[model samples]
Target chain A: MKVASGLLAFVLMFSSQAYARQTFEVDLQLEARVYTENALQSEQKDASLSLAVTPEWYRDWQGGAHSITVTPFARVDSADDERTHGDIRELHWQGVLGQWEILVGISRVFWGRTELLHLVDTINQDDALENLDGEDKLGQPMLRINYVADNGSSTRLFVLPYFRERAFPGEEGRLRPPLPVDDNDPLYQSGAEEKHVDWALRHQGWVGALDYGVAWFSGNQRDPKLVPGSVVPVMTPVGPRLQVQSLRPFYGLMDQFSVDAQYTAGDWLFKLEALWRDEFNSVATALNPAIERRDDYSAASLGFERTFYGVSGNASDIGVLAEYLWDERGDEGSGFQNDLFVGARWAANDVAGTALLAGVVVDLEEYSQFYSVEFSRRIGSASKLSVEARAFHDVPPEDRSFFLVRRDGYLQLEYNLYF
Target chain B: MNHPRRKINVLAAILLSLVAGTSLAQYDGLSAEDKGLAIAREADRRDLGWGDSSATMNMVLRNRQGDESVREMRNKALEVADDGDKSLIIFDEPRDVRGTALLTFSHRVGDDDQWLYLPALKRVKRIASSNKSGPFMGSEFAYEDISSQEVEKYTYRYLRDETLNGQDCFVIERDPVDEDSGYSRQIVWMDKAEYRVQKVEYYDRKDSHLKTLTFHDYQQYLNKHWRAQRLEMVNHQTMKSTTLTFADYTFANGFDDREFNQSGLARMR
Candidate 1:
């Protein structure tokens, strides 16, 4: 509640005092979902409804040399009590002074070119409470500087002062960890903890037909390790005592060197994202004390996308995408390692702006497939309707990751209104 | 059949002979194709140096059933030394689509380079030329149509001269040399006095009538260059049309080459 008020004040102040002006867009989304099975033994129903609202504002000033953008978002879910949330998605100021550019405040930065693997996009913490898709992110506080070279290349330096913890759903939420993640009991390897100042440097340029960006980041890991720490028996006033479980979050220091590039030639778009990361690679357990160590691993992804237009004698277009994911850890790697992803996008290009996307990620070792189908169309000039279906099939128990959410596959329908 | 009619015919025959004699003498040094090339070259020369220009435009699209929609944007163009102009368009309105900007580095040789910045994603995407024939922002104007019109892009042939809207105009048909071009040929009419394009008819790749565009309300800027205030393009097959109203024409804005590149797209607004 305090953060909400502070954001409102900031927006009102900026909008009122600026000599220039900005354009505003408001988007409201109403989502409904039906789970294939109950979240737990005590859940009454399998269907849920939710609402999400987003307002975006941006403007340029000082002869268009400077700009500021603000976007605030909030959501409320009817069935999933833990899904109700709000946050400042972005509030940043950017300005160009001669050959140097400066940016301050909260921002979100994307670096990878591939569709599935975002190896170098490590700026903001994912809002995992929303869904497994990593598109949504919470605001990150940082100060950055960019220097432009005469040869059309640029180098940017980032100084991140605050760390944002990745959000997780409650125990009652489906497709979640077996035990609740104790977000409030976060622990850190570094003494600075949440106040640790992490840093990153990136250089981007174009070479002939290909454009590439190389990035290096060293700081705390965005992913956390959940450890069962304390368990206590609570005394009840009347009948029986209840046993409660407590979990602690641990973040490790990590260093990542990554490169992402794209080559554009006519209708074909080829992209690659590769990374070498050093961190604690294994999950630590109370019984296995050797899990903590400085380990290095390598991973990469390669993909190509092609579009065919005027399909079926209409103005529609269809794009086919295929990518191969690789991880050096082999059997020790997560479910994403050694997987093949193939997808297709069908754009009707009609007045309704109808579109459909179907994709599947198949594990090479076990042949377990995570498939999804998404379709969307505009209801009018300001509103859009989207439907999505997801399924998981055929997985051995040793593929422990895929086996967890095997029954969490479901369908979702969403409507969005934009102003 | 009658004495008066014979006299009138004799007079008309003499006048026709005189007109034919003058036309033959006028083409003594050139063939029909050469004459067409010369006229196109002259038209290109006349539009050579306003140096740079910028304008705000409102585009209105209408469907076959009379449904209407609108888009607002601003365009800035810089004339390259020996190549086609570099142009950038910044969309400002309809709210949701605002802050979208497109930068194009048109060239007289090969293909034009283009980029688009999506505001919602804060990402700049390089546009491939394979879809250059696609409609721009769902308007009647295709992406290729908005690129700088270069002289080397087309081959010209002289058609004829006719009076359109009380102005004497030269009509010529030009065929695009680009293999991926959606159109087979285009016929353009230029006013003889100002060398301003007054109308154009586009032929699809199948050599079928596709669209017609008419320019109106031209005004001279800086007393040396003419800029059309209104342009209307109607698709013959779809029965849909789009009209663009241009305003706030400014020239010699001191925009450098640095401001027309892909890096400048995000700051256009």
Candidate 2:
């Protein structure tokens, strides 16, 4: 928190400089969601409303060779207090010197080619409360140095000094497990905990139609293991005694190597994202003796996308996408282990910029299915409207992840105003 | 991405056709197609030696009701020695799309390579450049209409010579060779003095008149290249129009290939 405030002060100092070319803007979003069924958890709600505001300020000097951007975001939710939060989406100063570029402060970086899963994009911690799609990320503090070659190849080195813990839905939040997670008490394998410094290196280049990147990261794992923290006995109408336990997040240090590539051929794009990780004390062994330690794991996602232009002689395009996801841990891995994802995207290509995307992910072993649809269009010059729906089906009771959200189907609507 | 440079090239071709004073009678006995090819070659030759250029553009799109929306962007181009030009475009307006950019590596032949950088996601995505007929950003200008026009992409024929808008012009008809092109053919009017294209009429696949584009306010840069400051494209069928206003045209900037690559796109200001 001190670092965040210090960066804010630095950005303010730069923006106050009269000679700097500065611009300010804000985005306000109103969102509402309705569930199709009642939540299985006692504190969950069937409907919720949220409002988010993000303000951005940017200043550039030295003829754009040096610049700084500051964007801070805050949200308020009616249903879940945990969902209401604040974050610095971006607050960074960037400098370009001939073939070299340097960035300092907090920022977000995405590194992946596949659509179904982003195994290689691990720079920022996931802001899960903002969205379930894993697209929203919290800004990470770092010092980044990048070098570019004449051939368009680039190598980036990152020194991350702090780690941001991933946010989860609260007890009153929808799409959460039966027991709410207690984030205040998190366990870490490293004594330095969240203060452990992380490092990452990536080199990316393109050859003909193919673009590829390889990266190495040493840091605390982004995804956390939920272990039973405390149990309390409660009185029930049908039973004399029942025990309920809340989950605690556990972070472990790990080294990950990842590679991603995309090959473009006409209207078809083939993409691949693969990663291998060696973990130390992957789980809280002292807390959960029944769980076996996972020392190493490998995961991969491969996909292809094909777009058909002017479908049916109209100014619209339809793209079909398919991918296969695999994890060496199989059923023990995330819900995406051994899954197939098929999706379709449609764009109207009109002044309104209308678009629709729909997809389904099916587990190969348990036959559990998750379906999603998203449609968005520009409302006017400075506003947009979006609608989204998600549903789960045939979720096996034995599946630990999907089973939690089996009855949490929902429809969401969002309106954004930009100025 | 390089639409500004492409637009300049379109105007440059027109200026060259008028500047080069080649004798027309040299091809008196040749077929109309050969004469047209000769004229195109002369225009291409006269437009060389530009090296590199950059410009800013303000695009206005108007619907049939006359409601208008504006878009602003910056473009930088590097003239490749043996191949087509490589260029980059950065969007600055509509506020929401600020910092979005595109990079293009056009080829004299075959498909061009293009990439789009989305700043919000911090991702660079390679997009298919095969949508030559699709509207660019919902504007009346199609992708093919704004891309760098290589002479080899079309077959030309000299139709006739006439006076248009107080200037003597040579009118020509060109048919696209790509089977997937949205146009059946295009008719161009090039001024006799500067060879700058004053107007273009497009025919759809059904041979129906679709759109007409007119250039205005021609200016000479470096005393060698002619650029149209304003280009208006009107879709005859939809009664909609798009106008592109260019400004701050700078040439001979000595841009290297590194400046036109994907890395430069993300850092475009």
Candidate 3:
């Protein structure tokens, strides 16, 4: 919290400079969703309202060489208490000197090539409360330096001094763990706990027809292990209620090396991402593992995407995407091992930006399947409407991955107005 | 004249005449194709040395029902001595599309390289060459139409000289060299005086009329080159049209090759 305040002060100091030119804008978004089922059976409501306001201030000085951006965001959710939160999304000062550049403060960084899973993207912790797709993230505090070579390749080094815990849905919220998690009690292998200074080095460039990124990270893993802490039995009005206790998030230190690449030739795109970790837990082990041990794992995913332009002689495109995933841990792996993911994206090249995407990820181990379909289109200049449906089938009762929420599927209709 | 100076002038004149004679003889072939090739070569040679340029552009799209939308952007280009050219475009309007940028490296023969930077995701997307035929941002213009058209990308033939709008112009038909191009051929009208393209008619793969583009308001820049102030394209198949208005043209911006690299795209603003 002190670091966040200090960064806020620094942003204010730069913006207050009389010689600097400052610009500010407010990004207001109001979204309402009508779900097909009750939210965790906690209420008689089938609708949820979410509002997010992000105010951004940018101060550019020293001509085109120096600039600072500060964006703070807050979101309120009426249905789920854990989804309501406030955060400083980004507060960074960037400067360029010759062929070198530097950035300091909290920032969001993304690195990946595929859509199914981001194997090489581990910079920031996932904001799970925002969505189940793992597409959103919280800003991370870092000091980064980038160097450019004459050949167009770039090298980046990031030094992270703090770690932020991931957010989870409340007990009353849908698609949550069986019991509520206590965010306050966290255990770490490092003596410094959350203060452990983590760092990463990355190099990005093109190799002939392939654009590639290779990175190595040494830090406390972002994903946490739920260790049972304390249990309390209470008497309820209906009966004696017995519930599990608070869970401590355990952060294990590990080193990960990853590489992601894409090669586009004519109408086809070839994508691949592979990584090796010192030690990490998949959803199975991290949740209900009979064995109390884990080992280093290696995983890789390869995919290809191709599109048929002007399909049926109309101004539309349909893209076919298929990928195969492999994990050395096999069935004891991340549940994505030996699985196949195939999807299609339909695009209507019009003013409305109409599009539909549907995909299914099939587990080869147990043949359980999860599929989703999403359709979205712009309603106006600053508004959009979308519908998404997700379902599961043939999921075994003892499958650690899907046993918890095997029946928790819903369809959602959302409308968002942006300002 | 002094004996040494006179001797030197005589030698220089002889050498200059010999070079000029050889250049003339090189085009002495009787075939009409040779003459057409020479004319195209000379047309391309005239616009060789403008180092760099920057321009602000506004694109207006109108549908058959007369519904209209607008997109505003800025473009920067750098000339390359070899290979093709490198250019960048930054979109500034439509609120949602602001800060979006595109960087393209056009090749003289094969497929060109392109990348788009999306600000919302903070990621750079590598666009496939097959998308070259698709409409640009849902406009009437295709990706290839908006790109920097290099002289070598097409094979040209001199059709005839005609008068259009009371101005003498050369009519030329050019076929795309790339087999994967969406355009079968393009017929262009170029002014005789300036060698600047005035109009073009495009044909699709089926050899049917596709779109027509007319350049308007040509003005001289740097006292040597001509810049079109506006370009309007009409799509005959869809009954849609788009107009691109160019303003604030500046030349010789001292842009170096290092600035056109892909890694520098996001930092351009």
**Which candidate should be chosen as best, given TM-score against the real structure?**
2
**Candidates sorted on TM-score, descending:** 2, 3, 1
Better of 1 and 3 by TM-score: 3
DockQ head-to-head 1 vs 2, winner: 2
User: What is the lDDT of every predicted structure here?
Assistant: 0.80, 0.87, 0.78
In model 1, which runs have C-alpha deviations exceeding 4 angstroms? A1-19, A38-45, A229-247, A280-289, A331-334, B1-28, B92-96, B261-263
True contacts kept of each: 0.18, 0.55, 0.42
Tens-place lDDT per residue, model 1, B1-269, is 56998899879767985765223233347877787777788778878887999999998889999888777899999998789888989987554557789888788877777778887656777766567667776788877777788888888988998999999998999888787778899999998878889999999988999999999999998787898899999999999999999999989888776576556776667
10 residues in a row with least lDDT, candidate 2 chain A: A283-292
> Candidate 3, clashing residue pairs?
none
- What TM-score would you give candidate 2 relative to the actual structure? 0.91
The weakest ten consecutive residues by lDDT in model 1 chain B span: B19-28
**lDDT for model 2:** 0.87
lDDT value, residue B130 of candidate 1: 69
Q: Tell me how far candidate 2 lies from the true structure as C-alpha RMSD in angstroms.
A: 7.3
* Local error of candidate 1 at residue A198 (angstroms): 1.2
Worst 10 residues of 1 chain A by lDDT: A280-289
Residue A239 in candidate 2, Cα distance off native in Å:
14
How do these models rank on DockQ, best leading? 2, 3, 1
At residue A331, candidate 2 shows an lDDT of 71
